[model samples]
Target: MAISEIQSVAERPEGNELAGRVALVTGGTRGIGAAICRALAGHGASVAAGFSHDRERAEAFRAELAAGGADVTLHRGNVSSAEDCRRTVQEVVDAHGQIDILVNNAGITMDRIVSKMADADWYDVIGVNLSGTFFMSKAALEHMLERGSGRIINISSIIGQTGNVGQANYAASKSGLFGLTMSLAKEAAFSLKRAGRLEAYGAGITVNAVAPGFIETEMLDSVPEKALERIRSEVPLHRLGRPEEVARVVRFLAADASSYITGQVWAINGGQEM
Candidate 1:
């Protein structure tokens, strides 16, 4: 059989089979995060999507996803705040007994040259991108550790690896996530081993990161058309990726199919880095 046929079969997850599984996606109200939420819910995972503000938008998204027959919950909280992170996680646990997947996709960008950037700009980017990931991961780790099976997928960016100009803050924040992914993977592995759940290695939990490039989202709506065209032209694939593309990768990581893959970064940038 062709690889596409195999993938099609594997992607068809039954609703009842994933009825009990719960997933938390940070900043899931819009863009790539929103896509991830829909993808996970479509596959039968009960979803909790976190948003920093705009309750109306969040609710609308929830209703839309719910209408599609996906169990979805919307939680409002600032991922950068430890207290909010704790509350968000608690809310999910309160609604559902345990968390099976955590998608740390909340992030921000305050673009400016390092020499001209204000300290606050740098701090804000790091706070949302790096610190937020830590806070959410810490909150989710408790339940995941107990379950002995979970998946943590962090959303990173290609700029984090290539170091974009006028985006030092963004680059630093994302690069930091790469370190966190590896470190957490090692820790989780050790914890699983100590708990005598070696067989649950990939099943229990696997943490990974997905770094995207030039995704056409609201964030990129501000980019000049000429610049975007240039960027698109540079990609070997000759186009920017869709939010759904990134979402599919997260779905795979969250599902049992990708049990053997962990602590890795999946770059979905239309082969830009390569």
Candidate 2:
């Protein structure tokens, strides 16, 4: 299908479901992260969209979001750095008073077969995709622990579950998120119910992941046309997933409706098998 023929999955948010909530979405300048940021803001959350670089695009994204009536700000930082992650979290809390939702959406792909993979390629993908999630989650959990309740939504990939050719490093990094999700969910539950210093979050907290497959985004621009067509042909839904479709799922997980769901993976893959 032509890109223009693909339907949009824009939000029709209602009831201010996330009103007064404060959220941070890393890699929020474009693609899935951008959609997630807009969805949260549309529901009345104060959002901080973080980008690693590309000042021009980030500024453009900021202006577009501002025009949409969102209470949004932009944060620039590299999530792979523990110190940077700590400072980013602290800055958000300092500005917004508290962070109730943390979407670990920052990631990258250094696709290569194991034999040909460079040292930097392996470490770079692992650092940004896996370690970045941990760094951000660790820093955010501190504030969430003290606050008594919170949400940590990790953005993983379908490759993590079933694996993929030329994606050894990517697969490993993403697969690691599932373990991290389950572990953190348990720890947060412990802190909330028993070991916690703050009793306000006795209501509990949640940590979950969203693993999307072949979303229609510029991320796939580098893929060859024939390969892309083959991917589309294999999907049970007969098409690529839309970014907003995935964002809606993230929004649901962030909302009160998903309060009971945690340590699980929600695959948004157009019914496609990994």
Candidate 3:
């Protein structure tokens, strides 16, 4: 499908359910991350779009969204750095006054066979994909726990679920999100309970993961056409997933209606796994 065919948020009829909320999305300037930003902002959330580099692209994205009447700001920093993650989170809160949603979508790939992978390859992928999620989540959780409400969405990958060749480091980092999501969910619950803020009617802090499969994004552009065809054939749907498809799910998980759901991984792979 042409990118133009994907429906814009303005085209949708849903309510502005996210009005007044603020969202911080790491790696939010392009591809799936960009789509996620559009989804949230389209629903009326103030968006903080985080990008590590490529200032021109980031600015263009902001301009496009701003022209569409979306409230968005650009935050630049490397998610791999703990201090950078902390500072990014702080900057979001400082600019937006509060953070109601945090999407740990920033990640990197240092793909190679286990034996051939460099130490930097393994550590770099783990640092950004796993530790970055931890650092950002911890910073956001501090503020979320105080308020007794928030959402933390981690973007894992299908490769994490069904490991792929030449992706040992990537797989380890992505799969690790499951443990972190569940653990943080439990910790959030315990903290809320200890604070006497875990009311039956209210939705307290929640943490979850969304794993996407074979999405049509620039990340896959380097793959040869024949390989892409093989991947498409492997999917039951016989088509590559769209970035917006992933974004829609992320938006759903971010909403108040999803308050009861937490500590679970939501797969958007078009029956590729099951």
Candidate 4:
């Protein structure tokens, strides 16, 4: 099937029965994160979207989703801080009772070669991408384990797998996320088995990652048109990916339809890896 036409198997099975599930999407005020929030809400999952510093933008997003009749709440917090991650997760649980899905989508890029990279830049990127995922996952796992069911989908990148020229920090952080996914998947399974809920979550709480490439978002707006055109030409599909395209993959992983999958990275790069 064509990439754009690939629909997640989850939505097809549950239909609208997802009404009671709660989802949290970090950095969800805009771009790919926003798309993920919208798609999940549309499918009946109550969504909580997080933003770092843009109160106005975050409020606006809440209003937009609400206007469309989506059960969405906005939370302001920096994912890099463990305190913020804890607070955000608490807010979601407080409002919704439990968190069924957690999307670790907040990340920042400080593109520079290793030789030219500043200590501050390296630290900042690692703090947000690697440490942030760790903190959020740790916080969310508590609730997921108690409930014996949940989904954690980390947003990684093609650059993480196939090294990029000027993103050593980004590549390392994303590569680390893959390792985190595997370890957590094993831990989650063990915990479920101990709780005697092994079958309940044999496919119950799956942790996965979605790696995207050359997506069209504000991050790439600065690229010259010529450069973007060249990138599109190189892709096997000859196109830059849309944020919604990545969001669909996230929606699938978050839903029960993906019950049997975990610790896997779904690359939405239009064959770039091949």
Candidate 5:
């Protein structure tokens, strides 16, 4: 489907499933991240969208959400830095009261064959993609744990699971998230247990990852045309996945409907990896 049509579709058709929730999405100004912000906002969640740069895109994101009457606020910060992540979280908490949901969607790629990959390239990708997730998750954990609940959803990738030829650093960072997800999930479980609130897996809080493959986002623009065609041909659906499709999965995980689940990696690929 065309992106415009996907954009027009109802992001929260389940009827305010996430009412009274507050969500922070990093790298939320464009592409999959933007779609996630709109989806969460549409579901009745007050959204705090974090962007490192690109003021024009950030303004447009605000406008899009405003047009739909979504409670979305824009926050500017670099996810790769611990201080910025903490500041961003605090600013949102101070304004919105609490962080009910955290979407670690901010990521970057400095692609190159491992042999030729510069040290800076590797560190840059790892810092933003992996370390950013850690920083944001840690910062938001304070409020979430105190409230006795939360949903931390990390945006991973197919490349992270199935190795990509020219993305060693990216793959490693994404793979690291799986371990992080499980560790955090169990930590939350035990912490709640210590507080004598040993409820079901999702009752206390949930930490999960959503890995997408070949989605229609600006990130794909960097791919060679032939490679993009190859990806499309491999997908059983014969097309790249839309950002909305991934956002819907995120919306579900954020809502009470997904309370019974946590620490799972949900793939949004069109059968590309499977």
Candidate 6:
């Protein structure tokens, strides 16, 4: 499908699936992150979009979503820093009263072969991708446990499942999320049970991951047309995935209906790795 056509699909149907919930999305100003924010807000959830830089772009995004009648706000912080993660989560809670959803979408790619990859490149990617997810999840879990409910959705990549060249760091970071998701899921479940609230609140917090394969985002803007064509050819659907497609999965996971699912990695790769 054409990129414009994919993006022009109408907003999600108006609903109250998450009307009383509050969501905080990291790196939520653009690309897939922005789509997740829009999807959650469109579903009637109050959204707090977190950004690290580009104040102008962040403000524009907030304005656009707010204009659409979304109860959305912006928070600026680097997810790589534990302090920043804690502060951002607190800011969201302070602003909205509670955080029911946490989307760890803030990530960076430092593409380079291991031989040529600088230490900074490796650490920076890991710091923001994998470590950031952990920091944010930890911070959000505090609130979730206090309330006995929440959703933690990590935005992983298909590369995490199927390794790629020149992306060792990126691959490793994303793959790490799978283990983190499962472990956190079990821990959250056990903690709630120990606290004698497992069955008290049927909507306890859930931790899950999503792996998107070759989505049509700015990340692909610099790739050669031939490379893009090869990517498309490899996908069974013959087209790159859309951000909204991934966002829908997140929306589902965020909903109360998905309470039975946890620690699973939902793939949205157009059949590339299935």
Candidate number of the best lDDT: 6
Looking at model 6, residue 198 earns an lDDT score of: 89
How close is every model to the real structure, measured as TM-score? 0.93, 0.92, 0.94, 0.93, 0.93, 0.94
lDDT of 5 by residue, 1-274 (tens): 4655443332434768788899999999899999998888887999999998888889988998988998888999988899999999999999899999999999998889989999999999999999999999999987788888899999999998898998899999999999999998989878878987665433468899999988999888867999888888999998999999999999988876676788999998988887
Candidate 4 TM-score, C-alpha based: 0.93
Position 142, candidate 2: lDDT: 87
Give all candidates' CA lDDT scores: 0.89, 0.87, 0.91, 0.89, 0.88, 0.92
Candidate 6 at residue 118, lDDT? Answer: 100
Question: Per-residue alpha-carbon lDDT of model 6 for 1-274, expressed as tens digits?
Answer: 4555433322234576888889999989999999999999988899999999999999999999989999998999988999999999999999999999999999999898899999999999999999999999999998999999889999999999999999999999999999999999999999999998886327777999999999988999999999999999999999999999999999999987678889999999999996
Model 1 pairs whose backbones collide: 148-204, 149-204, 150-204, 150-205
Candidate 6 least-lDDT 10 residues: 5-14
**Candidate 5 Cα outliers beyond 4 Å, as residue runs:** 1-13, 200-202
In the range 1-274, model 2's lDDT, one tens digit per residue, is 3333222111224648788789999998899999999999888888999999898999998889899888788899999999999999998988899898999999899888989999999999999999999999999998988877789999999999889999999999999999999999988887777763433313257999999999989999999999999998989888899999999999888875566788999999987864
Model 5 scores a C-alpha lDDT of 0.88
Q: Which regions of candidate 3 deviate over 4 angstroms? A: 1-13
- After superposition on all C-alphas, the RMSD of every candidate to the true structure, in Å, is 4.0, 7.9, 6.8, 5.0, 6.8, 7.3
What's the CA RMSD of model 4 in angstroms?
5.0
lDDT of 1 by residue, 1-274 (tens): 4667546434545543344679999999999999999888887889999998999999999999989988888888888899999999999999877899999999998888989999999999999999999999988988888878888999999998899989999999999999999999989888888988756323657889999999979999989999999999989999999999999889878876677888999999999888
- Pull out the clashing pairs in model 2: 148-201
Q: Model 4: which residue pairs collide?
A: 201-204
Give the local distance difference test score of model 2.
0.87
